[model samples]
Target: MTQAEGGLRARKKRETRAALAEAALRLALEKGPDNVTVEEIAEAADVSVRTFFNYFPHKEHAILGRNPEHIERALDRMREAPAEESPLTTMRFIVHDVLRDLEGEGELSRRGELIMASPHLLYQLMLSSFEDERQLTEALAERMGEPATSVRPALIVSASGAACRVAMERHKADPDRPIRELVDEGFQLLAEGIDPGFRVVPTKGHP
Candidate 1:
């Protein structure tokens, strides 16, 4: 009931969630996602199966290490952007803030590789991303003083998601390249407006 007690409880919960996710990723790496089970993950993390369910709805989420709080934090940051800033500018800030933390985390690259190797995990990740985009659309609409059903908000959020996805794919291909640079370039292209039919021209007789 005391503030200290509540804080301790929250911290413990986070520790449990993180332990479960780490165990899940380890098991997934050794046995693949299809071979890992909730019971095994819980046992590995020293938690009960019920506790694992409390942290993650399914094993894929644990393997992906998807944190719902990150989405909420990004939404909060986007909503706080200056009213004078354009939506794209606000989005750029949000994307950078959310992903910058991953720069030094080597585990993220490993997780990305694991996800890419499994078709089912990739599908689950895509579904989770779509849900995050939907939440972001709603938040953006609120900040823009528009209805959630408005076309512009949906368009902006969807476009931003697509750009981020492309950047991530490129990062996966070349881990040496800084992901932040790719993400920035993707947002820059969005800000500059890409020509729908734009194509590269061949030099000399190269065509």
Candidate 2:
């Protein structure tokens, strides 16, 4: 096939995938996600159930519309980060880059409401997040010239993940508040090291 043909096919697939996701979200909003089915979503998007499955493994995935591209870009950024940059700082920039486009209203607000209202969807998203964290952890470890199982890589990943979670929760609580601003605050707290005035005792096994 010609380059033009390949490009067109890729675009068409993206369009179909997006249509299915939009249909899934809209249906979930109108009739809870548990009530929506693959057939219904496909019909709404003018696609076949087989096509929907090709795009998403299940209905919940369709509703979540998790974009692979965003995570891929994030992983690339971490891998290419300068050697001198701290892992936390690298993560801050990566998060900002991934979420910057989502700063405004419209789809962002609708997704917040959808996920917050549905426990099932939230669980699915959580699972996806774990996978994303794992991939990012490996990339960060490679950049640090350390094993992925090392405590340092895991620590950075966990801490950065907490910051992202807090920012997300705050955004859900108030859609009017810019998500980027909240994310910045979370990263800033991480940068400062969450140290309370009082000293804390280390666990028996850990220093």
Give the alpha carbon lDDT tens digit for every residue of 149-175 in model 1: 999988888888778777778888888
Clashing pairs for model 1 are none
**How does each model score on lDDT?**
0.85, 0.83
- Regions of model 1 farther than 4 Å from truth: 101-106, 196-207
Each model's TM-score?
0.87, 0.88
Q: Superposing every Cα of model 1 onto the true structure, what RMSD results?
A: 5.4
| Local lDDT at 198 for model 1 | 84
Model 2: weakest 10-residue lDDT segment is: 100-109
Query: For model 2, how does the per-residue alpha-carbon lDDT over 1-207 read when each residue is reduced to its tens digit?
Result: 999999999899877877888898899889988999999999999988988888899999989887787799999999889889889999988888766644431366677678878888889988998999999999988899898788888778878877876777898888777777887888888778777565778989999
Error at 109, model 2, angstroms:
1.6
Instruction: Please state the error at residue 55 of candidate 2 in Å.
Output: 1.1
- Evaluated against the true structure, the overall lDDT of model 1 is 0.85
